[model samples]
Structures are given as structure tokens and as C-alpha cells.
Target: MCDILVPLTANAQRIGTEEERKLLDQSIQLCQRLLIEVTLSEATKLVGRAEYEDALPGSIQALRFSLEIYGSGRSELIPCYILLAEANLGLSRFKQAEECLCNANWILIKTRDNDKKVKSILYRGFGRLYAAQGKREEALRQLANDVSPNAALTDTVC
Candidate 1:
């Protein structure tokens, strides 16, 4: 499953009331439980309402747990790296995000998933990192690549 951090962050931004905050906390806890013992759509659902920085540690832990359960050879690795990169980006940890993105890109390239949706994620991650570094051109390039109509080409590297 993919972790769409931007949407998650946007949803989390709606947390203003104490009741909403409590619900978010409960969702986070449920996500942790699901990640710890079982794979559940509930966990993915919870992710959409999670604050990135706040969810970073748990997301990383969830990925590790998934890797452990599914074995290192499984295909869950790419999304794990993507989640980590997005979390790091949310925390303004550009270097960590870049490193994670590098790993994610490597996985994607190796897997040869010709899916632009996955490629777009990698590009979006890079765009965030470049934007943080004040590299406007690089950021724009990455963002453009993310939304490019024909990102199926090999040169469409993030």
C-alpha cells in the first residue's frame, strides 16, 4: 500500500478541536496495533489523517515490521522507503528525505514498475527536498516530472 503523505498532512491540518485530536490519536494507536500484528486497511485509512512529522516514527516502524514479516525480498520495500522520505520531508529533514528518495528510486528502477503513479511519488519527494534547499529550478523540474503526461519513459528519473 502507498502512503500519500500530502493528503495525510492536509487532513491532519483539519485537527483543531480536542475531539478531533483525540480521534487522530486513537487512529494512530490503531494503526500501530495493526502494523504490529496484522495488515489492515484500517491502518492505511488512518494514514490519511495523520500528521507527517508526528507519524514519521510509527511509519518507519511499520515499514520495518512489514519487512520483517514479509521478508526482505518482498515488494513492500519501495513504499516503505517512500513513506520514510515523505515523513522526513515533513520534518524538514532534507538530507534524510534525499537519502530515502535515492533508495526508493533504486527500488523502483530495479523493479521496473513502469507505473507513473509510483514514479510521480519519487519525483514529488525530490521536489519537496529541492524546494527545501531553495533550488527553485530543481524543485520545478521535479514537480513538473511528477505531473508529466508521459512519465513512462526511462529518462523520467526522479
Candidate 2:
């Protein structure tokens, strides 16, 4: 089930013909009903294993599916963005990672979401991204933000 749904959902995002859009809509519906959690979990595990290349498609699929379900700039999409950032960071794709983190930050700002755990994840991702880029001071600042009790309220990553 996951094997089939994963590619279907991921590829549907590309070929944007009218027929593909219809297929994408159907795929999104199926993903929401059944495969979202499974796909995300697999993607997370792949990232945990440092298999960034393998994880990208699943992370992307999860992000698109979340977008379909929650709309843009919703807090619900934060985790998917974070996961993508993590994968990109692992792969040394710094620009892509930064973009993903920026997207998450924008969503946080737009939604005014105050979930500390989510903010922690976002800051941690930024910390790692900066660290990977050899920006020591920025890395430390982001890591500090990740741990600071009031960081969620004080920091805006965008």
C-alpha cells in the first residue's frame, strides 16, 4: 500500500497537466485517508539512518500532502518542512535546507503558532544548518535559542 502510494503522491506533484492535477487530487485524498502517517514515519526513519537521498521523495510527498490537507502557512505543515530541512542538511544541500527552514519559519509567523516543541525543532534545524555551513556564531545562537525557555516567544527565524 505504501509502496504504491508513495510514488503516486510524490510524482503527482510534478506533471501538472489537467489529468495529472486530477490524479494528484485523488492521490492527496487517498494519502489523507491512509498513507500520510506511514509516509512521514518512513521518511523520518530514513533521515534517522542518514539516508537523505532516499528520504527526500517521501519528505516531499508528506509536505505536499500536508499542504493539500492543511493549506499553506498552516502549523500542521511545520514538521514536514523540518524533516525536509534535516534531510537536506544531512545531504549537505545547505541552500535547500535553509529554504526549508525558511518555509517553516514563515509558516510559524503566519500562523503565530506557539508550540514550544515545534519551535525547538525549527531552531535545532537552523542550528544544524548553520553548524554545517561553518557559521559558528550563528550556529551557537540558534542552538541557544533551541534550549532557551523563552526562545519560542523571543525568536523569529524568518
Candidate 3:
């Protein structure tokens, strides 16, 4: 319901990509629960596509913007963080990815929302993060927390 405008002077580019812009438009257009759900769904699907170099950034931006508006209490926040961690994992930005996952974990526990599913995803992100750091032992430990049990998988998260 509020218009957000930023000054664009001196070769300023959009903070996020076109796909992110569209998702934000869709979320804002309706300003209803269902529309937000749709936006979250679309963003998750985009993250699941795993084309990291392209789509993930936009999805990440869209999710972050959505969270900024919706607040961290929403269930969708966990997925957004997971998607962000995955994107960072793909790009080998281990520290940022770890921070994202840690935030998700903190929210989940703080809210007392016993959603094991989201926790599993968080563990997967941790697994990937550790793997990216070449810490196989830690990676395996976290990866074991995921839904699908695997000890021999070469790259559980990465």
C-alpha cells in the first residue's frame, strides 16, 4: 500500500533483477494472504530450479523484500533463508550462507514453531556450507540431520 521509490541518478541500476520485480509486483498487487502464498511458492520453485547464476538472485531479492514487509514471524521466512543459503552455497559464499541458515534456526527456535521440515532444510544448508568449506566431517554430521540419510554422498549440500 505504500509506494517505494529510490533515487536513480548516475548510472544507478535496479537492486534486484526482473523476475524479482515481477514477484514483488504479484505480492503487492493483491496484498492478501493467498497472493503472498503464491509469491512464496513461485520464489521457492525458482530456488528449487537451482540455476543459481541467474534466477536465484532474483528470488532471493524477492524473498528478502517480502520478508521485510511481512516480518520474520511468517512461516515463509524459513524457506527464504534456506533458498538464500542454497544460492550462496552455489556461489561458494560460505560465510553468508552460514549466517542465513543460522538466522533461520534462531527464528525457528525462538518462535517455538516445531517445524522439523524447515529444520531439515536448514541442516541441509549447513551441510552444504560445511562441504563448501572442505570440512567433510562437519558436512557429514549436518547432512545426517537431513530427511534422507546419507553418509557416502559426495556432495550432500553443495
Candidate number of the best TM-score:
2
True-structure RMSD, every candidate: 13.0, 5.3, 9.7
Q: TM-score for each prediction?
A: 0.64, 0.80, 0.63
Model 1 ranges with Cα > 4 A deviation: 1-50, 154-158
- Model 2 residue 91 CA deviation (Å) reads 0.4
lDDT of each structure?
A: 0.67, 0.83, 0.64
lDDT of 2 by residue, 81-101 (tens): 888999999999999999999
Number of backbone clashes in candidate 3: 0
lDDT of 2 at 143: 92
- Name every residue pair that clashes in candidate 2: none
Candidate 3 on 1-158: residue-level lDDT in tens?
11222221123444588998777656543454443455456656655776565645545555655565677766657777776777777778788788778877777767877666676777777877888899999888888867554422322232
Candidate 1 lDDT for residue 83: 73
The 10 consecutive residues of candidate 2 with the worst lDDT sum are: 6-15
Candidate 3 stretches with Cα past 4 Å from truth are 1-29, 32-46, 147-158
Q: Single out the weakest 10-residue window by summed lDDT for candidate 3.
A: 1-10
